[model samples]
Target: MKAYIVSLAAGVAVGLLYNVIDVKSPAPPIVALIGLLGMVAGEHAIPFARMVLAHVTS
Candidate 1:
């Protein structure tokens, strides 16, 4: 998706900027990735749950 690509690009730009400045990420790689995974899962899960609830009620 365009949004995903743009977000990825922005993240890469920020990462490169951080690298250029010799600044470490706020969170370690593994921790940050796990957090990202949780966020993605949560984003989908909430919408899916609502859809299921609507279907069951209808």
Candidate 2:
């Protein structure tokens, strides 16, 4: 989606900037990536749980 593309572009830009500055990234890359994954999963978690609960109750 558009949001995903924009986020990816922003991340790439930040990465390039970090490389140019020769400074360590603010967070470890693996940890940051996992945190982002958790955020995406968390966004859907509530809606998916509600759908399942509604089906069960119906």
Candidate 3:
């Protein structure tokens, strides 16, 4: 569907932005995947943060 494609693009865009804005290091593929998942779920930016939290707490 068109919406799916849009969400996918948005996810990649988010990942790219993260890579640009984050001073620590380059964004990983997993980070992009999480962003994509967030897009699909209609969760905006919170899911990406949750993913990072999960990684850090693990």
Candidate 4:
């Protein structure tokens, strides 16, 4: 719950800033969010795969 609130607050703050600047969003928000999710998953997956392989080989 706390994490969700923080994320929502940060997003709203960024949106407010962009509104103040009068600049359009550079990319689609959903696309960018998906990319971030991919990044997080990939970052953790590589280490997890290595651990699994190491255990199997040993």
Q: For candidate 3, give the lDDT of residue 30.
A: 79
Give the winner by lDDT: 2
What is the number of backbone collisions in each predicted candidate, taken in the order shown? 0, 0, 0, 0
Candidate 2: tens digits of C-alpha lDDT, residues 1-58: 9998999899899989999999787866897889998999999999999999999999
Question: How well does candidate 1 score on lDDT at residue 33?
Answer: 88
Compared with the true structure, the alpha-carbon lDDT of candidate 4 equals 0.91
Q: State which candidate has the highest TM-score.
A: 1
Model 1, backbone clash pairs (residues 3+ apart or across chains), number: 0
The TM-score that candidate 3 achieves is 0.39
Q: List the residue pairs that clash in candidate 1.
A: none
Tens-place lDDT per residue, model 1, 1-58, is 9999999999899999999999997856897889999999988998999999999999
Clashing pairs in 4: none
Residue-level lDDT of model 3, residues 1-58, one tens digit each, is: 9998999899788778777987443545877979887777786467888999999999
Q: Looking at model 4, report the run of 10 residues with the lowest lDDT sum.
A: 23-32
Model 4 lDDT per residue over 1-58, tens place: 9999999899888888999999787757898889999999999998999999999999
Q: Give TM per candidate.
A: 0.52, 0.51, 0.39, 0.46
